[model samples]
Target: MTKIRALSEADLPAVGEIYAHYVTATAATFDETPPGLQEWRAKAEGIARAGLPFLVAEVDGEVAGYAYVAQYRPKPAYRHTLEDTIYLAPGRTGRGLGRLLLGELIAKLSGTRARTLVAVIADSGDPASARLHTAFGFEEAGRLKAVGFKHGRWIDTVLLQLDLTK
Candidate 1:
């Protein structure tokens, strides 16, 4: 059985590895290089310090995927908006884990002061992500054409938003 819970310091290595796969092997993320364990720990700590939600999905005590929300922008005007990031292990997609992770993350955020949740998807071809967000009531907000270049091609970012006020 898979379980969702708050991220822990022990999960950093697995989380970093899961994210490294996407960073190096896919356009799911535009990062050219993956951060080390220390970087992941520091980032997790910072997010926790900011009182945001950072979650992980564990299957039989193994980290299968993770998700988190961060301030959409550093400016005070954007305080009520948050951006989500979710990633699953290389072989973990299409198995309902994405939805589980994202669902739990969204539930945790609902009680917060955030009024909007945004998902900045890297590729339109990533239907699973689009579907996951859509399943959770996120609507397409906008699309930026060829805004990112990765894997020798220009990539478009699809922006989706969910109103938390409702």
Candidate 2:
């Protein structure tokens, strides 16, 4: 059975493995180099310490995915906005885990200082991600063409936002 729960500090190594796959296998993320496991752990720890939601999907003792929300910007004006990120294990895509995580995150974030959640997806045939966000009532707010470069090509970014206050 798959269980979803808060990500403890010890879960970062597994989370890093899931993130590493994207650096080499796909352009889902714009990160060209996967950080070391220690760095990744610290990142996760910081998110958790900030009172933000960082969750993991564990299936029978193995972490299948992780998701979290980060501050949209460093400005005080953006305090009520957050950007979401989700990464699944290499072979764990298409299992509806992303939906589960996103849904849980929305519920948790809605009660916090964040009033809006944004997902900036790489717009290159990534319908699964778009569909997941849409299922959570996130609407397409904007699209920036050629704003990101990965895998030797320019990739567009689709901005999807969910208004948690309403």
**Clash pairs of candidate 1?**
none
Clashes of 2: 0
lDDT measured at residue 59 in model 2 versus the true structure, 0 to 100: 87
How many clashes in each structure? 0, 0
RMSD of each: 0.9, 1.1
Worst 10 residues of 2 by lDDT: 41-50
Error of 1 at 104 (Å): 0.9
Query: How many times do residue backbones clash in model 1?
Result: 0
Instruction: Give, for candidate 1, the lowest lDDT window spanning 10 residues.
Output: 123-132
| Model 1 stretches with alpha carbons more than 4 Å out | none
Alpha-carbon RMSD, candidate 1: 0.9
Give the lDDT of residue 60 in candidate 1. 88
Could you give candidate 1's per-residue lDDT for residues 33-60 as a string of tens digits? Answer: 9999999988899899989999999998
Q: For model 2, what is the C-alpha lDDT against the true structure? A: 0.89
